[model samples]
Target: MQDLTKEPRLSKKQYLVVASMLFGLFFGAGNLIFPLHLGQIAGHNWLPAALGFLVTAVVLPLLSVLAISAVHAEGVYDVGRPLGRWFALLFMVLIHFTIGPLFGTPRTATVSFTTGVAPLLPKSWETGGLLLFSALFFLAAFLLSYKERKITSAVGKVLNPVFLVLLFFLFFVAYSHALGNPNAQAATTAYRNGGMSFFNGFLQGYNTMDALAGLAFGVTVVTAVRGLGLKREGSVAKVTAKAGVMATGAIGVVYLFLIVLGSMSVSHFKPSAEGGTAFNQVVTYYFGTAGHALLATLLTVTCLTTAVGLVAAFAQDFHKHFPVLSYVQWLALMAFASFLTANFGLETIIAWSTPMLMFLYPFCMVLILLSVTAHWFGRDPVVYTLTVGFTTIPAVLDMVASFPAVVSQSSVGVALTHFRDSFLPFASLGMGWVVPAVVGLVLGLGFHFASQRRQAGAATSNDVQPDNAD
Candidate 1:
């Protein structure tokens, strides 16, 4: 392999352009619209929700980029080394499936359907229109993916900027003119849980799946900057970090602006709409039908790009691991799977994704911590296993509790309610998992180093005794 750390460097202009590309790659309008809906529903609790949303949506994604940069890691699984290859591959496959067809592709269809198809259709034509529109949607995605280089870049540069500029315009108008009262309380059962409400929003943000995607994208950013003459791994890391920081800052600004817009709009707008619906109303209120149309187009394009990039990556990764499968074959399989999954619609996708995110986010966070902490414990597997084991227990219970089917049980479902009831720590909204995991990591490291010292001492003592006998 090439010595990536020894390559050339990028200029300031190239760095910023790299950052812009990074921002565009991650910042789909679909991501933006969801927050507006979350905010409108959250109302006065928007702060907590927004804070939570930023963790998964912004912060973790940023860290994911850092994870790749820290080791010049090629992908998420590369960084998953401390966990073992098989474990990493299992995770990589799960992450790819979740972000690919299982949740992602269908989301593209649904978001595109609601934004593009639903607005023009009546109640009578809804179901058939959805089926027709999504079929055509993925079909287009399939065809365009065949000529990927041209379509991906064209959409990225042309359609993306237009969408972003229009979005800023809408946010500016909404924020400046204001809506109704800015101080309505959260009425939903989800928000009634107190401080944990914010965390719930945070975890919900993970469903966007951007953080995991960002890890994969770090390679793209590095490669792009490298093309511009930045070759050294350190330089690439520096540029990538700067670009990630810029992208995160931009996302943060937009999320904050939109949440405030959603919050202030409460007096004038009812929280009847879910996710993008409330957002579309706010857009239509300001930009009218034409504005809504433009937003729809942008979302479709944003989703298209995300869908294509995800498909391309999945195919490439699949081929890399199992060389017998060709890229085209994998792409076909993925698009087909995505088409079926997409039919499930956005509401269902979002509902099912929550539990999965709750389980994975902590694991993702732990991986990030371990990658950075590798040298501290001498990169010992025992330490890794101990910390991960501690983390998984609470996360597993949280996953079951939050599962869409069980979330409504009130007892965290029937028999499980007894489990949580007996386990007091699990009762406090699953935040109980965070502290113990951290403690386990700390204690595990201590034990790892202590054992290592004993082993080294015994080896030295044994060697010295041989000389004494001689």
Candidate 2:
């Protein structure tokens, strides 16, 4: 058997191809809505807000890609090796569930129900229609998935182009009309917070979880590329990278455009709406009923596709790790679980996702950083554990602070919040962990290198011939 630990050489072209698939997997309509809302809030400050959003949206996602590439990770689990095998498995499972039924799937159902299904139904029929429609939607997705990845990939290719065109129509119409309007008001608080807009945007971007998900999805991209006959590791990496860059580039443009549209709407629309509602209002104002219908349909279909893809991807990963579990069983289990969660709706899903991201993103980010710097750190497990542990502590504390309601009742939660309040990092926005994590990495590396030098000196002393003469 080939040693799994040995390095695999994927060509740059292959990397680009893998990258593209990864990008496609990462971007979705749900990712589009929030920033637009932010823009509406930020108004003139949209630039800084956009920058912050881009940090999580663009830079963080890119960092995830770089992290996976650095370690030549086979999957997200592999990247989390610093945390240990059981921890890796737990992390993977958490990611899959979060992006699948518990968070993303439910959001898909809710978004579609509100935007697509609800419009057609009377208010009384809305709830029933939502449940029914989501069931049918996920069922169709599961059936389509049975056709295999190539078919799925082909559909993705077609859907992506169509989705892009639809999005173009969306932005173009909004931009033209908003610009033509005789008068428009600027957004409230567009340029306040003393330049915290970027930071806020970054936090908002984290909600996408695309970068975190990418580490998991990398295996999918690699597997798909390999099936396409680019067996060489280096070639695969190159192709994936190209594809990834293109895909994310597309997503970035779309996100910025949507944010601009949101900013423009602040002049005419209410600021109370979140991401999905903001999108609906923009569509209604620009295109009227017909435009709303089109937007809803597109979002529903996209979310359905995303849900199917995620469930299928998770099942595939699970089977690989646990050979005893048949693929079909895993798929069915994930689909059923997702179906149950999809009933919760988009708003609720997003609400609950925050603390989870708080708890997990730091670890995910540290993994990337460590993997990239593995060479400098001597690939030592000790260094990995130290950086990750130190970084994760504050992250965990922040997670507790952010979810006061959830944690307030539990002993663990109570303890965490009590301690966290005293910590400067926890008192800040959910990101008190970033600075300390970086410091920990630096300190840990310093100690490691010093110890290594001391060991070297001792070894040299023992080997020296002068000892025999004495």
Candidate 3:
């Protein structure tokens, strides 16, 4: 058997490959459109708004990856293992569902179709087009993800670079042509104030869902690192962190570029309802008829890479925990489910996903923060439980409040919304959980230190008694 005690590491080229794979996994449908949309809304204030977006979009996701590495977690399950087995299992299931077939996976197909292909079809044929397109999309994803070991090479070496080259080409052409004056555009009503613009941008970043993906993608990165001959856990984690930085840094730069692109586009076109629409408009304006084909290819390639990563991560983790189904079986189930969900259309998928994102983002943020800081508190269960417990109430309330207007307008929803707004600080801003999470952290730490002091005092008494008896 090979000695696992020896420290091993990937060379610079291997690290770059791993980083590229990670970039492909995280930079999916939402990553493309969200920044573009934000740019239009923030307009002249795009800088602060973009910075805010970066906090949740770029910074939080990067922290999550490092958090996994910091704790030497094997996967999402291990990230939550400090809380307990059942909680860990539950956390893992929820995360996989959110980022897998339910929201993230289906979204890839719908987004690619709506942004890239739908414009080419007649209005009446849009529905049929989506159904056919998503079917093909998921099939392609399934094939790509069938072999787990080859994912790194397939995505990192091939699809990622192709997508980047296409995307950068679009950027270069737009800049060369002087699409618009971003500075001249006025901020929208929602983003009129700089502080609110920042907060709105921060909240907008939640839509990218990259932080959740970071947790799910941790295993993939770690596995790739291990395959590179890193046998020691610490070495694997160290290299994983490096790869994450490289990947997210690239993602951040892309987000800024897209945001700037969006801001510039406003000079020539009106604000679009969605970023996908904005992207389509911009591409059409610059490339004319050929842009349609280019965008279709670009989006399909981008979303396909992400879909493969999500499906693979979901299957690998689920099969590890629940072995009743083989990895291939789980993969098939996810693809089918995602295909069905995609038919619901891009708008519908996004509408339903909002509430779930609102609910889950808080929990995800808290968990990531705790995991990163676990060393300071020695990864105490008391801290984890109490902190999560405090976060749950607000998260649930936020979910209720964020539900579609049909539900939010109901009596029950009104009551809960009222209660949340009245009692929870920052509830109006959709960040009601922030203050409570902080309070929970402080209280949990207090209890932990108190318990430690009592234990130390009892040990001292026991020592004194032994001396007295002697």
lDDT of 3: 0.91
Tens-place lDDT digits, model 1, residues 186-242: 536676554765866776687678887786565456555566666567777777778
| Worst window of 10 by summed lDDT in candidate 3 | 461-470
RMSD of 1: 3.5
Best by TM-score: 3
lDDT tens per residue, model 3, 1-470: 97657765567998899999999999999999999999998999999999999999999999999999999987889889989999999999998998887789999999999889988999999999999999999998989889887888889999999999999999899889877788889889999989999999999999999999999988777777777778778888888899899999999999999999999999888888999989999999998989999999999999999998899989889999999999999999999999999988878888888899999999999999999999999999999988999999999999998889998889999999999999999999999999999999999999999999999999999877755544
Backbone clashes under 3 angstroms, per model: 7, 42, 0
List where candidate 1 sits over 4 angstroms from the true fold: 1-8, 139-156, 181-197, 218-232, 406-413, 424-427, 455-470
Per lDDT, what order, best first? 3, 1, 2
Q: Select the stronger candidate by TM-score from 2 and 3.
A: 3
Which residue pairs in candidate 1 collide? Answer: 5-233, 7-231, 7-232, 8-231, 52-202, 106-342, 181-267
lDDT for each of the candidates?
0.72, 0.70, 0.91
Per-candidate alpha-carbon RMSD to the true structure? 3.5, 4.0, 1.4
Q: Residue 421 error for model 2, in Å?
A: 4.1
Off by over 4 Å in 2: 1-20, 179-191, 404-418, 458-470
Model 2: residue 322 alpha-carbon error in angstroms: 2.2
Model 1 poorest ten-residue lDDT run: 147-156
- The stretch of ten residues in a row with the least summed lDDT in candidate 2 is 179-188
